[model samples]
Target chain A: MEPKVKSAMQMKIQVRKKKTIVAKDRLFSFLFILPSILAIAIFVYGFIGWTGYVSLSNWNSQIPDFSFAGLKNYVSLFHDFRFQADLRNTAVFMILFIVLVLGMGLMIAVFLDQKIKFENLFRNIFFFPMALSFIVTGVVWQWILNPSTGVNLLMKKVGIEPMWYTSVKVIPGVEWGKIQVGIPIAVIAVVIAAVWQMTGFSVAMYLAGLRAIPDEVREAARMDGATEFQIFRKIIFPLLLPITISVIIIMAHISLKIFDLIYAMTGPGANFVTDVPGVYMFETTFRGNYYASGAAIAIIMLLSVAIFIVPYLLSNRKGES
Target chain B: MKKKWFAFLSFMLALSLLLVGCNSDRASKSGGNGTRLDIFSWWTGAGEEDGLKALIKLFKEKHPEVKVENAAVAGGAGTNAKAVLASRMQGNDPPATFQVHGGAELNDGWVAAGKMKPLNELYKEEGWNDKFPKELIDLVSKDGNIYSVPVNIHRGNVLWYNKRIFKDNGLKAPKTFAEFFKVADQLKAKGITPLALGDKEPWTATQLFEDVLLGTLGPDDYKKLWTKEVSFDDPKVKEAVKTFKKMLGYINKDHSSRNWQDASQLVGKGEAAMNIMGDWAKGYFVNDLKLKVNKDFGWVTTPGTQHSFMVITDTFGLPKGIKNEDDVMKFLSLLGSVEGQDTFNPLKGSIPARIDADPSKYDAYGRLTMKEFKKARITPSLAHGSAAPEGVVTKVNNAVNIFVTQQNEAQFIDALKTAASELK
Candidate 1:
């Protein structure tokens, strides 16, 4: 063979090998992710599909009866008093929990943003509750908020009698169809406990956001003769909106599926006031063996969760675009 | 080459995690063929736990070849334990035996699910049919097949009172509705809570309500109500609701915050006059809280129901798919035996389910209870699951919880009528 021809053959082989390397890299990444996608499809999506099917059936008895009853479980849920109470509780809890957590978190982050002494110590102290499980926080708060023995003891000294978590629905209940809708007084105590534990997460996020805001922007505003309040109101708060949305989405999801905390602290407080979907779903499934109703509840929770999370994902996609 | 190595590493890691998940499941299934006995119960409290340990020790001595695992879950009134059992059963890993309340809790919860192995053959062989009371036997049976062996019985309608408080106020144990109200009125005027009720669990209120039902409607009518021979909306049932509502008005203000034990404490401390709780409160009082029985506190059947015994029996059933059926049967036989019942019940602070339990082994309350169990017309309890199904109990609990706060008599009656449909 001619030397030029042999050299051309070797160069062609090397170029082909480089091209194959890129293809091989892409192939390997796909292979790695394929198992996860398949797993999620089978396990998560499969269970979800199964639950939806169950919800449309009359599987209330111990036996898993999957004969289609259609729209019945959902229709029953809409009229169901316990489910209505659960919805009312969840709405109130979500609003109260998010607002308080955000407010406390922002306040703490702003304080920490300042050149304060023992900043790390104070940060850790606030974040400490987040480190503990919701169950742990719930139990500790349960003892502390006990109407007779806990904070009420302190209140007793000041000639005040407070019911704490034991207090029934404070909001004068109005008939919402067959169900009575009201702000459960007991849920307020739960909100305070939930907020205390979760505020640290928001604090960390808000702190990062506050720190990420350039000092030059604030300085420029100051130089333009803007008051501190005006600078915060106009610049800092608006800049933190993205982070605020993230916090709201994350916290709302956590609040929706709240079971362990409520179960441990107070097992369905007076008239199911502290009752939420997670607890109701658990009890209906395990306690009553109402598989269909429980599935209906799970689907409702998933849909409600999507109401918050779907928009966030779409917004993230838009930001990237 | 390094990229290939990374790919291989990640692949192996994923495979290992998948293997790890599969392995634990296999480990549980593998034990099914082994000579292992796993006894599950929620008896993890002071006296209850000690009683369970003693029962295990006796079983150990009798069947030393069997490897025993005490799968007792510690929690309030077995609610958490039921959640654990549900998950375990769902995984198809049933224990050798697990504690169940005799009636609808076992039958409606597990038997209805086809999770329980019928124990009629065991009963025939062990002669438990003649050993246990027929009414009690009826509770453990569905369609003539005995499902479980009753270990001990806790009377739900027993009203415990502070002896000092009653004596201090010159009050006798109220035996009728009129007498109860008269005494309650006097106690109220003295600023003493007439009834110390801790309904934190809500079923505790249902317990009080069931007693009120028994008092309002006699034993036959009460039994008829559960069987659905009579409706829940019976005028007598209405009267029971009225009585229960009246009883609720006389209870402690902070009743919802405390459990049954805490209410017993209120009575023990002489702050409240009386508490209508199960006989287990006697265990909590004497064994845990360390108060003398019959001296610090005394008990009578919850008023107007002295002729009827409100029986709440703790039973153990053979769940399906357990390893060593023969070995498990030995445990069930022993559970029914006088020796097992006597050893377990004395420490448990409840009267043994077996009629032959030695009277000498029990306290004064147990002796009195044993006598009453034999003489009084036997009726099953609803809240603790001898009379009603879990579906019924769950609905009743939800309704009772709302009723405790709402105090709407019509709503409470309406709820009971709904729960009655669960039996059908």
Candidate 2:
């Protein structure tokens, strides 16, 4: 009976020691996170808060006086023809960019997985563009896409005599005539550049997803006399759903905040053709309309990303569950 | 475990103290230096760099104790520099001295906020009114107070042409719009593009529009149109637009995407006939590219204009919260002085702000511009000068760009009307 009581007392002492160790672990974890928290609070949160405040006031160039005109900036933004145009351009770019990047990415990944020659070389070739800065890629793309100086001249040398880059013609009877347009050309150039840069990233992710599938699953399908195409369509594609959704969400976020490529390729003048919400925000702030309207636009862009991402992430979580 | 926690806390406290010390040191260095002045500008390239260095050298020689640090933001039209400057100023960390054109755009926000110090006292002390050109003095002053120092007078109405091309065609410099068209026709007949135009930059198009307005419509009408006194639909304004559109026929087919320097090179290489750009193009010709002034190229104002020269000037403004007030005063005094203006302007490919400078020291074109200055043929360019406000200028630029590229006269008129109405 005394031995039994001593054993219980020993167990109680052990339990108390474990609790102290757990508390110590928790304290270390908190300490580890403190610096990151401070950094985010000071740099990220502070800038965001400052931008929000600036967006409430009309701060023009060289002038520092900003008056709180409350919602007047928003009213003006609604009426701003350029801002509306930019929204339309950004929407079109986002939709088209996502479709192209994902579609191309999956196809390339699948082709590489088929035991092609120079597999590593091909993968590296596709991924090399991703490593370049957007500014450098933009400049290269601009040189390639410039109608007068680039592809047009190359085509001329090849005896193709390309006329499409210079002039725009619509069906005469369709309430439109031949009107010269560069905006569409500019947008296409931006998309091509973006896809070139991002397809490698998508390919890498898709490859990982493909590799995660167990060999037994494929062998079992083969044993069932399922064709390769049938196996890929029915089994492999379905498993990639999560990865595909994640890629779409991430690419969408990237497309929304795309500024450097567009800015470098074409200056503010591109606002006529390829202005996105990001570029518009820049112009607005630079033009000294730095108050409610700028903030409103930023908020609008944030809400848009949230609207798309929240549902996607929720579904992803549910899929995991 | 307690000792570990105590050590971690102490380390964190030390780190925080270290950060605080570093930040305070930075703040003091940037904001508390009495002899140091930070000047931000968008000047780069060998020629411009040389010119700026010369000016800085002179400034330092005059004020031995002061140290001038140049924050050069190199981009054409200063769009990048403007963005950086806006962000910095918004963060309440403006540079000591910054470049701003002498116009409403330069004075827009800072002047309204009372963030710009009036240079009126400096102007009086330096006797700037007696030395500087009256037109330039008027250009830099707002509400009877000088806020910026006019550095160099840029003639924006100069029409530069390859002298060889003109001579080969047996055509003299056109003195009237009618004569200019005839010359254009002659060049076209000879299978040459009459105008070597670069319209990729909208400002280039705007410059063309301003030149046409000043040359065809005269200064009063141009000012009235720019200031929104007259609607764009007015028959005279429409006439000006029509004339400009007609001139567009003389440009190359690929003029839509060429750079201004490349366009100038077209003339330099004798590929195209002429280029109507600002006098700064002279720098590209005579200074950098080694084309002789009045020999390889010729510079003239657009024909039959009441005002022979449309002048714009580069100016600088001191931001509020300037660290060294005495240094700011010294800088302002130096900027307005005859010696400073003369030394800086010639290197900048612009005429001096002070009319009292010796013309013998200037280039042929500069001397000619100085002569125009003497004859009172100087008028402010609406494109670069102080005719319209900033928002209005941007709107007009967009409208003109659309007009040129879209070739939609009605849309152009509507856009202009909208822009004009916004001014009020």
Candidate 3:
């Protein structure tokens, strides 16, 4: 009985020791991540908070006048002609860019999934543009779409001379209060360039999704005497819905905040036809030194991106649970 | 084991803190013992770079003890450099001396923000009161305090045309709006582009409009527009906008896709007749395109702007918090010197800002402009950020960009009136 009691005492000490070790492990892991957490908190969240404060202040000039002006800057931006155009351009660019990226991505992914010859060569060819930066893409596309030369040379032979990015014709032009609301034809040129550069990313995602689908799904449909088209429509397409949603969310955020490409290629084209919030924010903040208005633009851009991202994250968490 | 892990974590944290501390310390360490002068500008192009290098070489010859860092950011027309400079200044880490446009960009941008120190003493000590033109010096001054030293002056109303194109078409350089249209009609009839405008950046379009404004309102009233002495809603301003629109009708259809250089190239190849740009185009012609100045290209002041010198000067000044004040002053004095201006301006294709600069050192175009600068009514250029604050300039650029496309004169006038509100 004394031996048993001694063993029990030993076990109790072991259990206590184990608890202490677990606490130590937790502390060590926390310590390991503490630096990153601190860096992110200070750099990312801290700067964002500072920017928000600056946006609400009357710091329009180079001097940092942090006097609280409430929503005065935001109110002005909404009334501003250039800012209105920027908002319209961002919306149109986002919708067109996402739809085109997803459509082309799915189509190309399906094509490659057919077990065709030279599949690796095709894949690499499609994926190659993803390696280059948006700046490089903008420059190259600028040359290609130059109204006087490049693609125009070929189009001229066909008796069809589209001015490319130079054209300022807005289709279905309904004059709104301050800005003309329509699809800026010049934006199409930017859209085409953006699609060429980013379609590869969506293609990569869709390809992965395509490969992950069990062959049994397709085989089972075939055994039920379903046509290939029917199998794709009823089974494969629905299965790829998650990837499509992800691609939409990813591409939507990218399109909303696009800057370098438009800046390098068009530069707030004739009548701000190709202008986006990103380009406007940069020029306003850095060039014009309208820091408050620039911060407002930046916040608007952030909200736009969040509109797509927040719901996506929530759904992802829900699905995981 | 737990103790060891904890010790490792502390070591890592300490190492990271040390590294960050070193970085901040290095960034803040400038002009200590070594006396480094960081000379910042956007002069990274072929001719301008050569001019800057030559000027630096001259400075080094005089002050051999000083180390000059050529921190020229390469974007056309200080597009990238201004942003970099703004951030640096706002961070209280300005360079030794940086290039700025002499007028409103210096006065309204830096001086008004309390970022620049007055250079009145430097100008007095250097006897620069009689060196630069009184009107020219006035551009760099605010409330009787000179803020910067003007290094070079670019004439913004110069109309550059291909001599061969003019000769082949039997056209002389137009001296008035009527003459310009006559020549434009002839060029258009011959299937040649009358004006080679590259308005992709919008500033080019604004430049064209400002030139028309100068021509329409003349120098005196044109200067009043920025001062609110002459309103944007005035009939003369509307006439200028109408003239600008008429001029736009003669531009190349592809003007929106090209930058200034591309448009100049059209004229060089004789596909287009004229390009109204600053004298910097002469540098592009002589240096980059390797074209003979007087033989290949001819210049005239933009129609009706013959006696009005649209001054766009590059100046350098002292920022408030820079460490090397004495070194920067030495550099500024060099920039303001006769030999310094001569050594730089010929290579840069701009006339010296100083009235006493040697004419023999300049090219034919430079010599002519130097002579013209003496008698001409010097006016600030709005398109090049001299006449108006950047806020107004940005808005006007937007208005002009829309006007270029929409051609709605009433709307354009309204936009300008709105932009003019920022002047006060």
Candidate 4:
């Protein structure tokens, strides 16, 4: 009976030591993560909070006058003709850019899948532009689209001289205040440059998506009397829905915050045709010294990107569940 | 084995490159007894940057112990520099000295924000009070305290014409708006663009309008417009807008796609007959395009504005919170010196702000402008940030851009009035 009592006492001590070791391990893990959390909290969230504060204040010039101005800046921006035009141009640029990139990316992916010669070389060529920054793209495209000197000069030899960025024409019948609520014709030139740089990303994504589908699925469709086109439509396209949505979300964020390309390529074109909120914000804050107005533009841009992403995320979570 | 060798070679090469980059960065950060003077400006183009470098070389000769940083940030005609300057100033990390236009851009913008130090002592110690013109000194001063020193003066009302085109077509330079229209009609009939306008940046259009306003209101009344003595709704202002609209019709068809440099090229190529730009175009023609001065091109004042000299002056001021005050003051003194002005302005395609600068060292065009400067009435340029405040200029820039495409005269006038009221 004394021996049995000693064995129980030994087991109790072992259990106590395991509990202490686990608590010590938990403390060490917490210590490891503390620095990262502190850094993120101070750097990222701290700056964002400061920017939000600046937006609410009357800080315009060299001095920081943090007097609370409420939503006055937002009210004024909504009434601004330039901001209205910026909204219309951004919408048209985003929609057209996505459509072109997706269509061209899918087409290129399908062509490469045919076992074309030098497929690796073609893939590299297609993906090369993605490696360049938007600033470089804007500068190169600026030279190419120069109305009198660039591609138009060559197009003149072909008896087809199209004004690439010089045209200030817009679609008719929609108007908001003094701003035209239609697609600016000149934005197409900018769209082409943006799409050229970004299509590589979509190509890689879509190609990977295409490769993920099993060869047996296509074989099963063909054996059931489905044609090649029928097999692709019924079997492949639907499978790419998730990837398409991801590409859309990624591109929407880029198009919303675009500044360097538009600033470099076509500055607030004739009557502000090519203006985006990013360019407008830059001018208002830095050049115009309207810091609050510029911050309003920043907040609006963030909200716009959120509007696109939040619904998509909710539905994605629902689908996963 | 070959793949491993290639990878090792690349790793070593990258490592060497990074080491070299870091070495140079450290070198640039230190020198001259640990004293670094940061001089900021927007002079990054070929001729302008060269002129700045020449001035720096002259400074090194005088003070070899002081290391200077040429912080030139270039974009959109100093818009990017101004933004960077604003951020730096607010962050309490102001440069030793920064470029600012004389007049309202300096006093009403920076000094009002309490970022600039009053330079009345510098002016007195250097005897610059007697060197620069009273009008210019007043522009750089606030309430009798001078704040900056002027370096170069670019005449904003200069009209450049292709000499061969005028001589071959049997045409003479016009002096009045009516004569200008007649000359434009003749040139237009001959399939030549009458005016080489590049409004892609919009301020070029505003520059032309400012010249028109000068002609319509005269210099005194024009000054009144800024001080709010005369309103933009005045009938005389309406006349100026009408004249500006008429002038716009004679511009190049592809003006919207071109910047000022591209428009200047039109005159150089003889594709267009005339361009109204600052005398900097003279440098482009003589230096860059290799055209002979007075032989390939000629200049006169813009039509009906010959009596008034529209001046765009580049000046540098000492911002508050400078670490190296003695070095900065020495630099400013050199910038105001006759030797420094002579070294800089001739190469920069501008006349020296100092009246004592030697005319023999300047080009033929520069000599002529110097002679005219001694006698002409000095009127400040509005578009170049001399006559108007920043807020007003921003509004005017936007309004001019809209009017260029919409051609709405009444709307343009109303916008100008709003700009005036907002400035008040």
Model 1 lDDT tens row, A240-317: 999999999999999998998888787787877888999989878877778898899999999999999999999899
Candidate with the greatest lDDT versus the true structure:
3
CAPRI band for model 3: medium
lDDT of 3 by residue, A1-321 (tens): 999999999999999999999998898789778777888998889988888999999998767899999999999999888889998888899999998999999999999998999999999999999999999999999888887778887898999988756877778778996888999999999999999999999899999999999999889989999998998899988999999999999889889889999988988888788998898898888777889999988988888888889999999999999
Model 1 sits at an interface RMSD, in angstroms, of 1.9
**Backbone collision tally, model 2:** 7
Clash counts per candidate, in order, are 0, 7, 0, 0
What TM-score, computed on C-alpha atoms, does each candidate reach? 0.94, 0.90, 0.96, 0.92
DockQ top scorer: 3
Candidate 4 reference-contact recovery: 0.62
lDDT of 1 at B209: 90
**Candidate 4 segments whose C-alpha is farther than 4 A from its true place:** A1-36, A313-321, B1-33
List DockQ, one per candidate, in order. 0.55, 0.32, 0.74, 0.36
Q: lDDT of all the models against the reference?
A: 0.87, 0.74, 0.90, 0.87
- TM-score head-to-head 2 vs 4, winner: 4
How well is each residue in B293-327 modelled by candidate 1, as lDDT tens digits? 87999888888999888988888888888668888
User: Once superposed on the true structure, which residue ranges of model 1 sit more than 4 Å away at CA?
Assistant: A1-15, A179-182, B1-17, B20-33
TM-score value, chain A, candidate 1:
0.93
Tens digit of lDDT per residue, candidate 2, span A75-128? Answer: 776666566656655776788789998999999998888788999999999999
Q: Rank the candidates by DockQ, best first.
A: 3, 1, 4, 2
Question: What fnat does each of the candidate structures reach?
Answer: 0.58, 0.20, 0.77, 0.62
